[model samples]
Target: MAFTFDGPLLLVGAGKMGGALLEGLIAQGLDAGRVRVQDPAPPADIAALLARHGIAAEASVADLTGPPGVIVVAVKPQVMDAVFPPVARLAGARTLVVSIAAGRTLKSFEAHLPAGAAVVRAMPNTPAAIGQGMTVCVPNAHATPAQRQLCEALMSAVGEVAWVEDEASMDAVTAVSGSGPAYVFLLTEALEKAALAAGLDAALARRLARSTVSGAGALLAESALDAAVLRHNVTSPGGTTAAALAVLMADGRFERLLKEAVLAGEGRSRELAK
Candidate 1:
């Protein structure tokens, strides 16, 4: 993908998400001199990663310099107030401020920056840790189309990118993909336990459970067929798969349970934003 933003990029944190972005950018051929990281006590592995990639990681925000073209805030929600001010001072007036802090709104950044700063709020999933993440970017009214494009380019280097006009939809995004990995992990665990209970050896159960889920995901990703159609393709009439489906779909229990779980996550996202 052709990208226009070429100046310095600053990241405020070096946690999982921040580290992932740095790695992705390096993979995308971003120059080491163009990226600067600000994180105290950076993880040793990530520190080595940045060092190996030739990107600079500073111990203090004061140590970072230059007129940033893209400044990403990847810190936790709880530390936003503490991190934003110094970053605001360092960012250029025309810099595009991108954030992946869950539940942190554009307005929150606006409060700490000069009026009319270009802010883009994003919610990215953990799969970003491995460059298969899905991210949603919502730009504030102050942001221009060019800035939005820059945001898309930066995020797409890691994985997929989508734009949302309504900020309220972020909570829903968080509820779905942001917390989606845990659901899949739980399913994997449950399948392994059930396989073990059904007289399978531990190693066999784990292999079956992991491979089945991963292969299904790979198939879905490579196909144009809808998930419902794919699922139906696997279920034969009066078969064992059908029997399992009957229990899972019975009385709409699974659907309702999933809905409740997403709602609970959405509520917590709102609470954290406060």
Candidate 2:
């Protein structure tokens, strides 16, 4: 994929999302020498991963030299204020900052950095850990076309990437894809309990529920058809699946419930941005 980004990258965090991006970038041929991690306390596994790759993590960016091609802030929104100031000092005319911290707007970074700091705010779901994530990005006015393209190349290494001109849409992106994994997980959790209630053994129930949810996701990913079409194909008249769908779909109950759930998440995302 003609990976192109001038200079090196300085990653500001080494947690789940950060760690996942690091792994993906390396697998896609980004040189280890071109990447540096700054995390005071990364998870044990991630620390080991850095060590194995011979990429040493700095406890702070205090001594790090830069004019890095990119600075990716994959930190928690709660600490961004404290953690980001130091990072902004490293920015040069060529640096592009891409942030995956939820609820942080491009304006938020602009407020802290010097004028003309090219900033992009991106939202990626948990699936990114395995490179199946859906990421949506919004770049500030300062970001150049080349920087935008570079952002796409950097992020697509971890998953599919999309762009939006309206940063307003990011709150919805946070609601739907960003926090949506938990909703799917809750369904699997509920299904496991329901299977047990229906007299299945514990082990079988666990296995069935987990496999069914994952398998259905795999099918959905592979098929070009819409999910509704796939659902209808599985549900025959008078069949068990049809019967269950009837109950869940009655009066559009399930769809309405899911809409409410997503709306709630959207509201919270907005709150965090404030």
Candidate 3:
């Protein structure tokens, strides 16, 4: 759905993910003049983009004038306490506050903001820097339907967005999509290393691994088939792919390892939330 906010939009950070969302919003025709960004040291690209588009950006939140319709907090989780007070001042009862800060809960935000302020707690991954992000958001009880939609629209600027009715699921969501990219990258690294050990040239192996992963991702995006189906289609019984799968899937090793990894991530997220 198209998203355009008539009132001011305040972005509390202009780092990688924040910059990506800013780029996406402008590309989707959100008026630059109505957007204000707060970042102490924005990357060169973000600074240039804001300047080119006539958007206002400052190092301090005090520079912004707001009762902003939307306030997106993209700061690091560790510094959220410092960030929220200034942000809270900009939030009216109708304001929708969407946060991409990992491990920060909706209730944590509500505690700092005005009574009954609408808030959405979101987890978006590093892939968001390139606009391939997957964001899962959960709204607090105070958030209205329209506020939730606005949060979804704002996040959709960078990549795909999904809403969760149960906030408890957010820990698992963080483990999955929020940390999923690193797992994919680790797989690529392992594949490249194995190829090199098999006598392939280092550069060639790296290139092949990169291409294979990216190409498979593209195919997955364009195909309607489930991933298991796609894997089956590529594997002929007793063939090379099947042989490789046999080792990877032996005694459910692969699935078990992934489950463990996700649990570790989820545990870490919960720990940080405290």
Candidate 4:
């Protein structure tokens, strides 16, 4: 079901991520007629669904109305400059600007909008497509509590959300959560490869790898136990699980490797900003 926001929504860039959010909103029971979207080639499913609800779809922002209650910027960061200037012109004084463009900041949006414009920057991962996304948002100084509430309500329609007082932490959030799905996918791939190396058929290995990881994650979600406790629960002394743990714990190898990988992601996020 689509979640309802306080008022109308204007979604820019109806690509994969944007389309997923639109579906989530409808699934949450948000009024589809109150939504407007602009995209060059919106997905067939999205276009049909929006049309069914009386929502308008246009090829360019110029065809959309001005000063939406919530204006979501889902366009790619590389094309943000080309996409937002006209939006800025159309933004009303009270319009809340929410951006999900990785590497772009609130200041960038503020620069394009009217003085004292409310801007919220968010980092959402690919998992949003599956409704398991972890998103982090932060508001510019000009944003009021009411505007923050609106942004939070709008983003929550897609997935869980958190806030960081320090804007610098946004880059770290991008490193950890924004790019986290790829890391998890990589782990699943490695597990499948390892299973194949252990003489399992490729198809069986993939099914086992994906199901095991996904099931364990679901269990963790339903449990009160912390991750460490969960790990200990699976590892009996002198058992196979313990044997695997021994290799993973040896010389702090896996921990160090993951730390390095996250640092690399963080660095790359900053580099993209430049």
Candidate 5:
């Protein structure tokens, strides 16, 4: 379902992810005039976009006059304590609060808002900046069906959206999709280094590594086959691909290393939530 706010939409931050969401909302045909943004010092580019779109921008939530229909919290987790109290004043019975801050729980938001306020906790990766994000949202009991649908639709403006029944699983979600982009980027860096080691020019190595990773990602997105199936398709028995796989797959080294990395990330997320 398409999402449009019934009243003014207040954006608590206009940093990278928040700015990206604003761009997506405008691209999806939401009226910029109905949006209000509060950021102490927005980046020059973001300020320009807000001016061009005629979105109301303020230095603080205290400058906002009326209650907003939707309150999107995009500030860093560290600053949420300072940001929540002032914004909570804007939460009426119908206000739907959607937070994209990692490691912050719905209960934490509810504690700061009015009793029974609808809250949705979401985790979106850095890819969201380019409209290719994968977001997972979980709503509290106070969130109605319509509110949940609205959250999904709003999130889909950036990319894929999934709903989770168990909030505890969010740490795993954080480990995977939330931190997943960095893993891909690291892989790209490693591939470039490997290419350089193989005598390729630095510029050529970077270009090839980037293109290969991006092209492979696009192929995975467009294809219905499983990733394992795609990998098998690329491998011919006793060939160069198989030779490389022998090392990567030997003693399940790669798999074990990845699992360890994910566990470490999950642990960190849990610590931050506390």
Candidate 6:
């Protein structure tokens, strides 16, 4: 589906994640004319981007000749309550409120909006900057099927999109894809450290760690085989990969630790909802 800029799109934040979405949307044929930024102090880069696109930025949501078709809530969760009332005013019957703020729920949006407000809660990871994002969204009952399509279209500008019927699943989604990138980075750091300890030069170790992880990820994404199958394929009998797997997978140590980490993240997400 083509994601035409059926704006005026009210983007409430101009931070890194939000800026990435705006840039991606533009690259995918969204018209900058219909976009506005509500950030009071966007970073210099984002301010320049807004100017380059000829999109207006304001301290508040304002001056649109018409009500916004979509109000993308990209502000931090802590500031959501303060931000919603003004947004509520601009969200007409035709409006679709799509929020990317972590831990902010549909019900929270409902409480601040007019009756029968349509809302979607979405979580997108940092990889969205490079158009490799993974976003999971859940819609309130009031959202129309057309609105869902629009949501999917806009999100697809950044990367892949998935939907879930259960909003509760967001906690796990937040734990996994939302925080998962940091885990991958940590793995890269560990690999680099290990390579250094193994007597490789710092620059070479860094290159090996980053390139190997990124290359493997690209392969995994493009491959038809599942990750386990790919892992097995790479492991020749008694080879280096097998030797490494033995230490990493011994007694399911890696799996257990990863599970624990994800669970802890999920628990924190749940707590934030409160």
**Residue 212 lDDT (model 3):** 99
Task: List, residue by residue over 1-274, the lDDT tens digit for candidate 6.
Answer: 3663355888999988899999999998887877878999988888898989998678976667778889998989888878777778887877899999999889988988889988999999999999999999999999889999999998988999999999999999999999999999999999999999999999999999999999999999999999999999999999999999999999999999999999999999999983
Q: TM-score, each model?
A: 0.96, 0.97, 0.95, 0.94, 0.97, 0.97
Model 1 per-residue lDDT tens digits across residues 39-123:
8867888889988977667766575546678889998888888877888887777888999998888888888887778999998
Across residues 147-240, which tens digit of lDDT does each residue of candidate 3 receive?
7887888888788999898888899999999999999999999999999999999999999999999999999989999999999999999999
Off by more than 4 A, model 4: 1-7, 63-66
Better of 1 and 2 by lDDT: 2
> Whose lDDT is greatest here?
2
User: How big is the positional error of residue 72 in model 1, measured in Å on the Cα after superposition?
Assistant: 0.5
Candidate 2 residues 33-128, lDDT tens each?
888899989999889989989998887766655578899999998999999988888888878999999988898898878899999999999999
What does candidate 4's lDDT look like per residue over 41-107, in tens digits? Answer: 7778867867777776787656544567788889988889988887778787888888888899777
RMSD of model 1 against the true structure: 1.3
Candidate 6 TM-score, C-alpha based: 0.97
User: What does each candidate score in C-alpha RMSD?
Assistant: 1.3, 1.1, 1.4, 2.0, 1.2, 1.2
Error of 3 at 76 (Å): 0.7
lDDT of 5 by residue, 1-274 (tens): 3565577888998988999988988898787878889888888888998989987568776755667899999988899998888898888889999999888898889988999899999898888889999999999998999999899888887899999988998999999999999999999999999999999999999999999999999999999999999999999999999999999999999999999999999988888884
Q: Which ten residues in a row have the lowest lDDT in candidate 2?
A: 59-68
